[model samples]
Target: MKPARPWFSAGPTAKRPGWSLAGLPTDLLGRGIRAPEVVERFAYALRLTREVLQVPDDYVACYLPASDTGAVEAALWAMLGQRPVQVVAFENFGLTWAADVRDHLKLDPEVIEAPWGELPDLSRVDPAKDVVFPWNGTTSGVRVPNADFISNEREGLSICDATSAAFAMPLDWPKLDVTTFSFQKALGGEAGIGVAVLSPRAVARLDTYRAPWPIPKVLRLQDGKGFDRALATGTMINTFSVMTIEDWIDALEWAQGIGGLETLIARTDANFAALSDWVERTDWIDFLAVRPEIRSTTSVCLKFTDPRVTGLPAEDQRAFVKRFKDLLEDEGAVFDMEPHRNAPPGLRLWCGCTVERADVEAATPWLDWAFGEALR
Candidate 1:
């Protein structure tokens, strides 16, 4: 059945009711650093995150540029010049990172890839080698096995792109050397800032692995004494978005007040369970991710099954996309259910904690309505 209205779409997901662009503090131009209080507040916020996540004192949390891509690139440039990079690909973003390793970084990477719906084999990972992969493939709604797959005694660093997973799920930091995330995901912070958390091992790797290529201004982590640990608070780079930093602080406060990361995880889990229940009862729809265990709790993906109405014909597929999108938007039930441009045509909904469970419950019927209308 088509949704009576379509109401769910994967990010930039939904905004919190009181979320406002104006709530952000100014001094994003880096002027905030001049004031000790401002800088202290920022650092304190970062410290709070570390405490909440149970990050060891040896681990440092730094504010990278505004985007998660920036954080990932910074870590790669600083820590990758020595080891042979192994990139694991299960979805579009992972493939993109792998490409960056090849074309931009110009490193010949050993790539282990799986199709969109599947996950890369964790057993194939050699803990002795440097590895890079996304924790959650937001576009495809597939998640990799946690850091438990990587042995603690591995020789190389494990860099994780967890933009969509941070705050929404638990990250096994003991097994992760370098983890990067954007504020936009579960935090619901505006775009432009990325958070990079690194363990002592990761810092050591950066200090030892001097890049063959010239490190750009933003990516370099060393300053004479080798990888300066202090850079984690000040961020080795220049010019930060103070406003974005404060936005992250606000998100962090909300997280703590609402029972922290565990609460957020439960919310997402509940949303996914709700969505899963609905999917089970629906005949025409099925999950793209074959294994329920690996399915992403944050991004719930689906496809229509009633081929009798809109299948087998390419024209019908195109029509289904248009009608489903239009129906959801028109009814205010959901937005942005269309598949990623690069992925198979299917629906992807963000069941993140920032979104209300009531909204998801309210949206299921809209999905049925949308399907019914499209089929008609």
Candidate 2:
């Protein structure tokens, strides 16, 4: 039988168990942005974010526009170039951040890179140089296994794009200076907003250092004075959707009510374990991240190992993967399971907090069936 709940998108995944449009708070709708009630709504979301993520009290979680990319860009443009910056690129989004530093920001960074499914030799990273990397390789399904490579006494900053890691993983906040993510990913919330948790060192960088370039108003967060406390504390410098904020608040409430961070992590772990067990028993599929430890527990990516498809030319391989995607999609047994445009021919599934373990287990049989029919 087809899966009971068949969604597997890597982002904007299935909503919480009892989520409903009517259940979301709507009293703040049509209220003024700076009004006390609306401000309280945003403040409540921020409080739950810090509590759910277990972020340190000193770090400021600022809500920014443009989603995860926006939060990353704000830090890159405003704080990079003060010292030697090292950009670590592995997956697509990691490569995107590296590009922003190299091409867009026009800075020559010490780039540490690896192929899509592998991580770089992180031990080679300089302790004294400012560094940037992703906590999770969203598209490639690789993640930094730990933060032991980062030095606790480094003089430079550590900027991490944690867009796909926040709700599902444990982060070493002390080792990180700037971290960015969105509620849209693991929490199944609305898109278009990003939250950045900045360390005291990161705030100091903003206050003391200059970017040597013109900063846009939308991305700008600091001035000659210091960090913008108003924005960092949930006040919007730009016009924002109250609907989005309400959705974010609702997601956090769901997460908190379900036992907070540990429960969220446990749910994702169960989902990943269910999916991983299938990949192990199946003969035709294998994880893209060969190193099991570094394999993402949230965005689990896999490639077909069957020679029927793998032996084809590169373009033909892509065509066959597309066929597999279409076969499953047409069956309504899966959705958004195709590999990203920049990734190799493969399947990506969301095993996040919002996804039930049984749903992931249910998907495996359909996946095998789809692959067999596609081969036929």
Candidate 3:
């Protein structure tokens, strides 16, 4: 077998070579008298995303101040201060956002939260009210079905956090008003920057709604009429990370070079298929998600199913999993396979296309080895 390239961590994962600033289109930031070509490149990258996802021409796509947190918070700050909020918390991070809405934003939000192991019922959500839901629960490895469930003519805004699902899955942009994602998830680009895509309705809300509390410098999006037009050009706020934005553009270019979004989706599907097949054959392991349809293809989480294995003390199970990660790293077969701290004590593997199939193939043996050693 060919040697494995180290990667597999979720955020800040391995990037394709020749993607640094030195190799980027220098004129994207525009040279002297051009005001940096990078801004236009950034706009172009957003346009490509819009095209790939089939976003409406009237909608605006722009980068945000920080990661998904920044974008989501900006959306909340811009759109929710006036209305009674409803938040759907399915995982740790989602719960964190709910807390932000209540504690930080001081909005008395009715929270519909499910235990970490399961997904909240979408039927319980009232689309007539402003709602916050992640398209894919990255930490929990659960995903929402689709946007068809959301009311098309609802009075309130539908704010979505699609950080992990943006490029990996098909987003119904028409049904979604406010959506945001970070490049680090499936894009494998740099962190510290986020992409915020807003439908015309969302822009209208931002333009119309005024928060009672002071809007932070980073979260402000209103142009003049309370609507955000900066989203159309590149960004609304201030300066952006030129280097990281260039990296994101290159990542898109690389995706296009390979086979575009369709090819990338297929690659993720294949990697998930490999893991799903392996998990089916193993009697000791099983998926955390109860339903196959709801399982996330990007972040595939697994737990020991054998009674003996599960019977081990919770701490012991966690230690065993940690040892499994250490063993895989020692063998140079995988890197950063630990489950997220906020999640159950189980292995959370990223089946992203950024990882070559050969590396995934070579890593399977190490999983067997680690499982055997831990079980023994």
**In terms of TM-score, which candidate is strongest?**
2
Query: Mind giving the per-residue lDDT tens digits that candidate 3 earns over 1-376?
Result: 4335668777766676345557865553434322645556667777776666556788888777888889999899878976677888888778988999999988889888887657788777676789898888888778887776688778788899988787788788878889998889887888988878888888888767788788888887876678667667774366666667678778887888887778888888887888888888878777887778778887777777878668888898788888888887777777887878878787787878787666667777678778888777
RMSD of 2: 1.1
Candidate 2 per-residue C-alpha lDDT over 1-376 given as tens digits, one digit per residue, 9 for 90 to 100: 7667788887777888778889877877888888998888888888889999999998998988899999999999999998988988898987888888889889999889999889999998888899999999989999999999999999999999998999899999999999999878989888889998999999999888888899888898886686887877788768889888888888888899989999999999999999999999998889999898899999899988888888989899888888888999898998889888889898999999999888888888889888888887
- Looking at candidate 2, what is the lDDT of residue 186? 89
* Weakest 10 consecutive residues of candidate 1 by summed lDDT: 1-10
Best-to-worst ranking by lDDT: 2, 1, 3
lDDT against the true structure, each candidate: 0.78, 0.89, 0.78
Model 1 residue 208 distance off true place after TM-score fit, in angstroms: 1.9
Q: What is the TM-score of each candidate against the true structure?
A: 0.91, 0.98, 0.92
**Cα displacement (Å) at residue 43, model 2:** 1.3
The deviation in Å at residue 20 for candidate 1 is 4.6
Instruction: Give per-residue CA lDDT, model 1, range 35-105, as digits (tens).
Output: 77766776777787776566778888887774788889988877785777899899888899899889988
Highest lDDT: which candidate?
2
* lDDT value, residue 180 of candidate 3: 91
